[model samples]
Target chain A: MKELLNLFLTFARIGALTFGGGYAMLPILQRELVDQRKWVTEEELMDYFAIGQTTPGVIAVNTATFIGQKRKGTLGGAIATLGVVFPSIVIISIVAMFINNFADSVILQNAFAGIRVSVYVLILNAVLKLWKSAIVDKIGIIIFIAIFSLSIFTNLSPILFIVGAGLAGFIAKRQQGVVS
Target chain B: MIYLRLFYEFLQTGLFAVGGGLATLPFLYDISDRTGWFSYGQLADMIAISESTPGAIGVNMATYSGNMVAGIPGGIIATLGLITPSIVIIVIVAHFLNKFKTNEGVQGVFYGLRPASTALIAAAGFSVVLIDLVDFDLFRQTGSFIQLMNWRALFLAIVLYILANHIRATKQLHPVIFIAFAALVGIIFNFGLN
Candidate 1:
């Protein structure tokens, strides 16, 4: 029960603080979950992001659910998922009541402009860290380039890239008999 | 009732919007067309608000859109509706992955997936930086390469980047702290006024 509450509060903090949605949650999650709590490793979090992206529904919610379920079970998963969105429900409801004011607030606009740049830096650093770990080998680099290109140059969903890369890795590794 | 409709509508969206928060946009567009819940302009406005606020963009949109339709209860119902699918799907997927976690084939799959996921995020990072640092709207208007930079944001970004990555003391600071500092800087400089 205590663990569940911790999960809830931790995720609620994550949901509340991250401004730009799913991808932006990465750096924060790395800090809170990996660096602070030791709930998951950076690698496990990457795994969750991959799975979260491929699965249906919002990636941020899926990640919360994944981490929670890893810790406790269905109920833990439910609680964590709830925690992540709880802030959204409350904050959005409040903001909705005065939607016009928020929409027109120049102060909020200026703040967001800065927030956006900071978030970009955060995501860029996270991506750089991920690159060092994820793109280690020749084949890994090849897959990275292919998927990166596909992500940019095509209108296809990332789910396709994930599935294809998984299959390619499976077949490629099997042929090499490299059980890494 | 409207509550049931909100739940049902977002449930469908939660199920089918398979990638992430942004993926929900087309479905929201469809909702506007079918249910007349909000207009395209309103949807755009909702997105702007969603982007500018905290929380997942999808949840914010549902809350804002539902509130527009039916007030506070509407926000709750719509949000609950949106997240329902994530809980169900992730729990099932997590269960299987836990069981297969040690399997070699699964390990191999993740090996490739790690890089793929990194690439996906890097792509997102590129798009984000592009959006934040470039004034494409202004570029299109004047068709002048030299005038394309959002100079204030770019300067802020460079300063923040160096502090975040280069300065050892600052690098160890919490990201939220940096974000807070950035927000402060943004307000002082009126970041978007230019």
Candidate 2:
């Protein structure tokens, strides 16, 4: 019971603080869950991220559920997911009911502009750290460049890119004569 | 009845909004088209709110639409509905997660997936910088790439990067601190009001 409460608060902090989307949550998740709590390792978080991307529902919600379930079972998953979405339910409801031109507020825009830049820097650092862990050999580099290039140049959906990369890895590893 | 309808629609969205929050946009447009719960302009407003406010964009959006349609209870139901699929699906996936983790072929796929996910993140960060720090729309009028740059934003970004990465003492500073500082700077400096 105490552990469930802890999980809820942790995810609630994540949900309330996250400004942009799932991508922005990466740095926060790394800092709080990965670095501080040590609940999930960097690699596990990445795995959850990968699954979260391909799976249905919001990536953030899927990730929270995955980790929560891992921590305390079905009940944990429910609590964590509720924690994440709880803030949105409250904040957006207030805005939807009371604030008509909240988005048009210059002050809010400026603050978000600043927030966006900060988010970018945080994401950049996360990517740099991930590079060390995720990219190990030539094949990893090849996969990185392929998707990186495609993403920058095309408007194609990321699901296709990820699924294609998984297939490529599945085949390439087998052809390399070893599964290690 | 509306609440049930809200739940059903968002349940479908939860089941199909693959990739992330942004991927839900099309289904939302479709919802507006079919149900008239909200107008297209209102949907755009919701997006703007989602972008500027906290939490996941998709969740914020669900809350906004439901609140508009049927008040607070409706908002709660819609959100619950949007996330119900994930709870059911992910819990099931988690049950078999160990099997997938140990499988060699699955291992191979992840071997590829790791770097690919990293690239996806890198690519995403790159675009955020482009959109937040540069203005192509404003460039059309000025006709100069240099002028198109939001110099103040870039300067803040560089300062932040240095503070967060280069300085050992500041490197340990919490991200929320940086976020708070950025907001303070924005409010004080009047960023991007021109």
Candidate 3:
């Protein structure tokens, strides 16, 4: 019971405080769950994050489900899902209730304007970190730049780019005599 | 008809948007073009609010877009449609997660997925940059590449990069700190929410 409560509270805090969405919450999630609590390992968290990225819905929620299931069981998954989602439900509900006043406030607006720059920085940092992790070779590097340029330059759907990159990576690995 | 389309559109987005919330941007842009339910500006607003608030940016945007389409009911439907697939997948995966962890095919799928995820995220970053930082249309008016740059935003990005890399004393500083500081600066500079 204590462990379950701890799981709930930990995710509740994460869900409550994190801003700029999943990628931005990731480092903090690492620190809290893996570093501080010892609830999960760094390797596990990385794996979970990788899975969360590819899986459906919110990364935070998906991650929480994985962690929760790992820790407790089916119940844990449900609890952690609730934990991860509770904050958003509450916060968004409140915002929905009082959003007009919140939006009209001058100070709040200014703060959001400034926060936009910070978000830009955070996203840039995430891109760099993920790039270092995902791009393993010269071919991967070429694919990265090509996809980045194509996405920026053309109106092509990212779905096609994603498919193309995956194929390129698969072929590159096959040529190198490794699955990668 | 529009409501059903909205549900299916977001369902598709939720199903395919790997790499989390930002990955949904391109799909949102495509939806905007197809449905005309929201403009690019409105999408930008949704992004801003989605990023600034709690939960996933994708979910927040879904909720916001749904609200735009048909108010509260729309919001609920969109959010549910986006989440259902994930819920089902997690439950099934949880049942066999331990066994599947060592599965080679699963490993290969994930290996292939990494690059694709990166590509989607990179595209998202560029789209946001184009919408928020650069003014290509404005450049067409000036008829010069040099005149088209939003130098303030560029300088801001550079400054942030340096600060992020250099601020060691507060290496423990939460990103919310930086976000708050940037918000204050934007206010002072009169970036205006609009």
Candidate 4:
């Protein structure tokens, strides 16, 4: 029970602090789960991140479930997932209720405009950091450029791209093994 | 009935929207088209609110859309539906795939997925610039370069980018502070009024 509560509180804190999106949660997750609690090593955290990205659903939630399940079984997974999404449900519900009240206010509209621009900057910063870490090889660069162009230029579903890239990577690795 | 539909729809979204929160945008857009639960303009508003708020944007969006459809219970149901797949999948993986991390096939998938996720995020960032800073529709209608851009927004974005990158204190400050500061600037300048 204590372990379950701890998992809940720790993930709740991560959920509450994360802004922008799943990517922005990385630093906070590293600090609390890795540096402070030592729940998982840095490599394990990265593996969780990778798994989270590949899996369906929100990366943050997937990651929380993975960590929680690792720690305390299925119930722990539920608790952690609930903890992470709890803040979003509460905050968004309130905002939805009040949004129409202030929707027409010029001041609020302008304020949102500014906030939107800043949000863009925050996302760009995330992209820059991910780029440095993700684009490690020539194949990585090729995949990045290909997907980036396809995403920008076409209306293709991202699922297709992700699946195709995975298959390609798998085949390439197999070929290297055979050659070596 | 509405709650059931909401859960079912968002469950599909949860099961298919890979790569992270922003990856769900296309699915949300499809939902809006099919169900008419929310308008495109409202979808934009949801994105803004979700991006600025704490927690995953995907979760925030699910909650907002569900609440719009059927109030608080709807929100809870939809969110629960959305995450249900994740919880189930992760638990199964945890139990069955203890050695999955070191498995070459899994590693290869991740090898490809890492860059793919980065590309998706980059695409998302580019679209945000188009939506927030550059008015492509206006540009097409007016055929004027200056009229094409929300100059104030562009300027503010650049300034924030520089501050975030160069200023030590600003760099260390939480993102919420920048968001608050930008909100203040927007109100003071009456941005987007024109």
Clashes by residue pair, model 1: none
Q: What is the lDDT of candidate 4?
A: 0.83
True contacts kept of each: 0.80, 0.80, 0.51, 0.82
Error of 1 at B128 (Å): 3.3
List each candidate's DockQ score. Answer: 0.46, 0.46, 0.42, 0.61
- Model 3: fnat (fraction of native contacts): 0.51
- Across B37-132, the per-residue lDDT of candidate 2 in tens digits comes to 987545644665676688998899899888889999999999999999999999998888767667778778778777887787677567546766
Task: Assess every candidate by TM-score.
Answer: 0.65, 0.65, 0.77, 0.83
Better of 2 and 3 by lDDT: 2
The share of true interface contacts that also appear in candidate 4 amounts to 0.82
Q: Write the per-residue lDDT of candidate 1 for residues B98-158, one digit (tens) a residue.
A: 6665676866776777788777767756754665577789999999987698887788889
- CA RMSD (A), model 3: 4.4
- What would the per-residue lDDT of candidate 4 be over residues A1-180, giving only the tens digit for each residue? 999999999999899999867878999999999999999999889988877877788999999998998898899999999999999998888888888677888888888877777777777887787788777899999999998898888877676777888887887777777899
DockQ category of candidate 4: medium
Q: Which candidate is the best by TM-score?
A: 4
Q: Is candidate 1 or candidate 3 better by lDDT?
A: 1
Q: Roughly what TM-score does model 3 have, to 2 decimal places?
A: 0.77
| Each candidate's interface RMSD | 5.2, 5.2, 3.3, 2.5
Model 2 over residues A55-87: C-alpha lDDT tens digits? 678989999999999999999999999999999
* lDDT measured at residue A90 in model 2 versus the true structure, 0 to 100: 88
Name the DockQ score for candidate 3: 0.42
Worst 10 residues of 2 chain B by lDDT: B40-49
